[model samples]
Every structure is written in structure tokens, then in C-alpha cells.
Target: MSQIVTLQAFLDHWAGSDPEKAAIASTVRTIAGTGVGIADLVARGPLEEGLARIHGSDPNGGGDTQKELDVIAEEAICAALREAPVAYLASEESEDLIALNPKGQLVVAVDPLDGSSNIDTNVSVGTIYSILPFTEADRDNPNAAVMKPGTNQLAAGFLAYGPATILVSSLGNGTQVFVYDRESSEFIMARDQVEIPVETREYGVNQSNMRHWDEAMSGWIKDCLAGKEGPRGKDFNMRWVGSMVADAFRIFTRGGVYVYSSDKRKGYENGRLRLIYEAFPIAMLTEQAGGGATDGKTRILDITPHHIHQRIPLVFGSKGEVEKIASYY
Candidate 1:
């Protein structure tokens, strides 16, 4: 018989004296009847399944990019969570927050596939999520209640489907890292109370959109370019992996700033990051790790998701750099 582990049990074990604390934990229980690994099966596995349906061949039939793989992966991840005990589910793949367990206490926001454009290149891609408490006393209308910001999240985490599929997350106390035990098909605690050094001067930003950036953004990049010769006397290293989850993971582990700003492009008026799923989850995780997240000017957690798949500019990381970006805005 396959070993069974319940998410609820995991949560209870993780939750200490603060029993009222509502949070989410990554559990790798086998799917009933299928015996397929839950933790091991991220967007890639689902992407393979979806691609099989579309191509009638294996995922290796042709070289696939992250964007293409993401489309397939999003569908699979959403489908997997259909029966999860969540109140409302939001994702970068959907146009709105999906109602799952209406009476459930938590709302889940997910990015089924992030940095998918990097997949063809074998770059690190992953999934991000935020969990918020949905109390009945909040409101009767589902839309109004779920419009809360990322700041309201009770827990947040990410799954890095890389050379080693790992899950990193926190429920307010501190950050925790877990490894996907393929044999046991469960997430075993790998690291606890993980910390990110604040003094690191690394920064992440997409330079391709430099031409479309606003004056403030342009000015900020110029300053960073000046490095030790500029307003900030410290040297700065720039990193842009083209994947929000991957970039955010970098910031989460090592201190750095990441920006996805609103450009002059017509379609990119707001920004590229999805507010509910991608940005919200990363914002929560960042804050929990003693970092900051913002929309250049306003704090990311304070901004509610106006729309289900609302896209917004994101600037987060070391407090100093993030604040500098906000100052420009």
C-alpha cells in the first residue's frame, strides 16, 4: 500500500501553540488510485500530459519553450487543485478567481508555470502560490472578499521544478525548505528558518524593455549601471532570468531587487506580473523572508487584486533597493 499523508495533518504538525494560525503546507501524498507523486508532479508533468494530447507525441517530440510549456502546465495544475480544500483559487492562467470549496477557510493563488519561456533553454522555472484566510465574517459576496491584497496572505510558497524539484515556503514564523522525496513521494523538511542576507547588492531586471520604460525606471537603471561610481557607492550586479518565480527564488535565497515595470507599450500598461497569483505569492514570501515587494510606488501586499488575473508592475527585494525604486516612482 502507498503511504498516505494529508495536507491537513502536515499543517497541524507545522502549526505549534498558535493553533488558530491558518496556513498552507506542501504535502506530497499520492493521488488516490493513481499512486502518482503529487510533489514530484509539477507543471512539467502536466505539461507533458497536455502536450501529449495536443501533439499526440511525447514532450520531447520537439523543443518547447517556457511559454508553450506553461500553457499546458497551467491547465494541469488547475485541474489537480480542483478538489483541494480551498475557498477560491486564482492563477496566472485564468481570467478570474475560481471558487473551489466555498466554505473553505483559505484562498489559494497560483502561478502554474513561471519562467516558461526559459524552459526550452533548460532554465529554472517553477510555481508560486499565496494562501489567505477566507473567514465567513469577511463578507457575503465572494468577489469583494477575495479582492484582498497579498499582504493578507496567511502563507506563501513556491515549487522549483529544476534539476531538483524543491518546495520552499513559510507560514509567518519563518521560511522552510523541502525536498521532493520521489521514493516516498512526499516533501520532507530539508531546511528550516532559512534566512536571506540583506547586504547583497545583486539586482534583477529585464533590460530588453529599456526603451519602453518610463523616465523614472530609465533613471533608476542608469544609476545602477553607474555602480560604485553612481549615487550608491556600492557595486551592483544585474540578473534577469526572464522568470518571475526563478528571479523571486533568487531574491528569496539571496538578497536582491527584481523589477517588472510598466512600460510604454500599449498592451503592457499595468505590467507583466499577475497580481493575484504570481506577484501576490512572491510578495508574501518576500516579506516573510524580511524583504519587501511593491509596484514601484505602492506596496504590493496593500494593493488588492482588482481583477482575477490583474497584471501589475513588481519591484521587490532588499529593503534599500526596493525603497530606492519606489522613491523614483
Candidate 2:
């Protein structure tokens, strides 16, 4: 098999294959640039002190509180993409889509800083992004392009700024992981063509929201909690890190499931995870990793996005576990 040493090397291998591959390479190159800056900011300690010193409390359209680093990360990503072939940009930090380059050929949707709520606690957070083709009609109405379904995404990925900065991505090829080499200032391939186990005995969910869940979801959780006494007659374990990127990384490393479903709570009927950025990109990566991603009743990639900031329920991870949850729905 061909050895894939670095992210640029991997992209170059693909770029040699086709024009579409070349475009993807260029876009991901820009994302990597932003990732470097984000890693640096994350590595520096005492984010809370900087948060208090740099900015006041400000919330995004989704009503999630944004920290100072969130804004800084968003700016860095936007700056990197400005010179890329990105025509329309949709971000979690922005209320609406922003047209960056009229003549560009790609549309990007991003969650500049996911899990920012954990920043103060010194927990892991990351950036998520989805890249779609920029069409002629999109030039006429950019929001239309920005609202394209996850199925339309040509590439999707996330940068996890944890103990070691990692970039997990898929370009309709397969899920791959790259770890940042601080000494080299490059992202080196750590895992290639990664796959999630078909079955798992572990699951991750926010148990605090149990009271607000509907019957189907509640029933599923009950079954999981029952362990050996449950319907499956096997023991199970639960995990929740309150950070999607961190949770996702664990699922990728080991076979498991992660659920963030809709509930009876206000503003949560359609779920809280953003479709274009958060759910879509993760869905793409999960599917590419031989896992599954759904909204309890439907495949996440198959859902037609109606708005740029549309939110949806997300249940993803090991194929069997995800399928089992969908069965309950």
C-alpha cells in the first residue's frame, strides 16, 4: 500500500487523480492553515482569564454563549478561506450567510468553535466544516447553495484541539486522521481509511435530558441502561464528554454510539445540532468511517436542508448501535 505521511502528501496524491481532487486539496489546505492558528490558541493556557479580558458575553444565533476565543477562531478561519475558492460562507457565529468571492467555485459551512461552553472549564473544543460546490444558481441566491443537503457536500472535516491537535476528515473517499507535529508545523497522517466497528457495547448521551425526550428515545435509553437485564441480555457502558469533537473522537477510536436527539424542550423539537456544519460534517465523517449517522428516523446525509442554520437531531457511531436506535424511532 502507498504510505501517506503528511496531510499535504495525501492531498497531493489525490490532486494527481482529478480536477475535483485538486479543488478539495486547495480548500483543505486553507482549513489546515486555520487549524494551525487554532491549535496555537488552544495550547496557550488560561483561556478563561483571556476570555474575561478580551470580550463580554455574546451569544450566537443558536443562543450558545460565545467565548472570546470563539470569535478569534472564526476570524482566523474566515481569513484563511478568503483567498480560497469559497463563494459562500455560512458560520455558526454569523446569523446569515456571507458571500466571500463572487467568482469562487466552492461553498463552505463551518462551526468555527464547537463545544465552546467547555472552554472555561479547560475542556476540549474544535472546529467543524463542510465544503460544497458553488453553482450558477448559488451565485443568484447564495443562501440556496448554503442550504444544500449534507449529501451535496464534497468534503467535510473537523479539527480537534485537544492534548494533541488532530484533523479528522473525509472527501467521499474514506475517513482519515492527521495529528499535528508542532516541531514540523505540519499535520501528519496518523490513521488512514479508518473504520468504525460494526458493533459496540458502549454509548454516549446527555442523560440529563431524559425527562424531555419522547417515548421512543426514552425507551431506547431505558433499554441501554438495563444492561444484562435489558432486552439484549448484555452489559453496556455509557459515556458523555459534553463536547461533540471529543465524544466523536472516542467513538472513532473505539466502537460506540453518540446520541443528541430532539426532545420536548422548547427550541429542541428539530434538535440543537446545526445541520450544515455540526451534524452534516460529522455525518459525512461517520459514514465514511463505516459508521452511521441519522436523525432517529432518517439518515442525516439524506435530509434536505431548508435553512442555513437549520438544526437536527444527531445519532451516530457504530452501525449496529445507530441502527438499533433508529429501530426504536
Candidate 3:
């Protein structure tokens, strides 16, 4: 049988009363409590009356349609953090930053229900979150405080709602994964200090956009397609889940690279994923797991966000694979 280590037990053991560590543990627990509830609604799916994807564009002006569950999940997360040590809550579903407790000392950036496009399809999706210490100096200037560089994140995590709910996170230490054990109604620590393999034969990208790819990207694709005859001298497998967290979960499980880069298509120049909520947190988690994350040119954690919803290109996973792709740029 798998060793049963509960989330609370893990946090209690790791935090052990350090103020910052305790705060981080508390904040993570708060969000996870709601995640458990969100998972229940997700499992109900179509059977739940009036539970449907909200058609049309998102209220945040994003092209994607907001789903019913997305709103519920966002509200639940917001409510959960209202008393936590979180001063500001920035969400993908919200147009502006939410002011929580004035005395709180941290900021939370989240995509409440990411990959909403797959909501109706019953495919994998998740909630991505980043926790950063609120800069007291810039407290009055929410923009400045919220736009801190990804390197400043104190903790980051994501709840992948799929075949089995997995809560993966890091508290500036190492990444760990917790599996939801329904029998005990707890998230059990299944893996600690997860390290991604240094090499991988698989890669994930959207092949439908091949025509819009830049020369460097096109060339890289050509080499991979060439298989044994290619410069890589080995065959490659391609996988695309059309969902960031789903793809990331696969990369964490084995070892693979997932890229959503700036193509020539309009509005895609900067890529699709939001930097603060999606890319930045994922980058932190990937690195904590002994992998790498970059934007073809610059490291993800090194990029400073200029706005709450800034988008960016992302290439992440195994170190060598990430570096090899960056060379093309």
C-alpha cells in the first residue's frame, strides 16, 4: 500500500511554526480546501442542472468563453482566501485585482478554472496559482506590487482535476504532488521533491499552427519530424492536450517539453498563457522539480510582469530539451 501522508500532516511537519512558512502553509491549505469542493462539482458534470459553459466571450475580455463552474470555482477560491494572509487576489476571471485583508502580507495570482474550453468535453483542466510576498513599500500601488518578477514568488501550486485530483506545489523549496484519497477525504502526499528526468523523447505543441510558425520554430519542427535522419538522430513523439495543466502534469509524470511560443499569427505574437497566473507559476513548479522554463530567449522567472494579465510565450520541461529549443531562436 502507498504510504498515507496527509496534506495537513505534511504542512505541519514542514512549516513547524516559522512565520513565513506557516503563512504559506496556511494560504496553500485555504485554497486547497476549496479545491476539494470544486472537484465535487466537476465530478457531477452534466448531471448537475443548469451547470453549463457560459457561452460568448469571457467578462475579462478574453476570447475564451467562461464556464459556469469557472465562476463558482473562482468565487470559492476568493472566499477561502479572504481570511488568509493574502492582501490581493488576482484572478483570470476578474478584470481587476481584488483587495482582501489590508493587514495580509501576501498576494495570490490565479487562473480559477484554466482550460475552460475543455469543460464540456470532460477533459483535464485545473486551477493555477502563485503566491508572492506583498511589498509593503508598494502596498499603495497595487500595480507595482502585483507586477513583481516571477522570481519573487514565495510559493506556487496548481490543482489538476482529472482522472485523480493531484495537487502539485512548491514553497520555494522543492515541488511535491499530493493525490486526493476519497476514502479518507484527504490529499495524501504521493511524491516528494519530484525531479523530472533530464532527457525525454517526447514533445508537445499545436501542430495545426505549423503554417504560422516562424523560421526557427519551423526548422525545429522539421528536425523532429525527420526522426533518425534528422539532426537529433532519434525519433520523437508529439502530444498536445490543448490544456496547460494537463500537459504539465504529463511532463511532471515522465519527462517532456511543452511549448506555446510566439507565432506569426495576429494576437499570438506574445503567446496565449498569462504570465502571472499560468506561465510564471508553472515555471516555478517545473524548476523546483529540477527542470527548466524559458521563453525561448529569457527565463520565465526572470521576466517582470508589467500588468496583472500580461501574456507570454512559454517553453518548459527537461533542461536540455528546453535549451535545445531555445537555440533555434
Residue 43's lDDT in candidate 3: 79
Ranking by lDDT: 3, 2, 1
Q: Give the TM-score of candidate 1.
A: 0.80
Q: How far does residue 11 in candidate 3 sit from its true spot (Å)?
A: 1.1
Task: Tell me the tens digit of each residue's lDDT in model 2 across 1-329.
Answer: 36639989889987896876787789998997788888777777584257424354434556566678878988888888888888878898887777787678888899988887777676788999999998887677888876766789999999998999989989899999999888998889998988999999999999999999999999998987888988978888999999999999999888799999999988899899988889999999999999999999999998898877788999999999999999997
Which predicted model would earn the best lDDT?
A: 3
Q: For each candidate, what is the lDDT?
A: 0.67, 0.87, 0.88
* Residue-pair clash count for candidate 2: 0
**Candidate 2, position 260, lDDT:** 96
**Compared with the true structure, what per-residue lDDT tens digits does model 3 show for residues 165-222?**
9899898789999999899988898888789988888999998998998888888888
lDDT of 2 at 207: 94
RMSD of 2: 1.9
For model 2, the local distance difference test gives 0.87
How many collisions between residues are there in candidate 1?
3
Which 10 successive residues of model 1 have the least lDDT summed?
A: 27-36
User: Model 1, range 191-240, lDDT digits (tens) per residue?
Assistant: 66666666567888879889999999999888878888899777889888
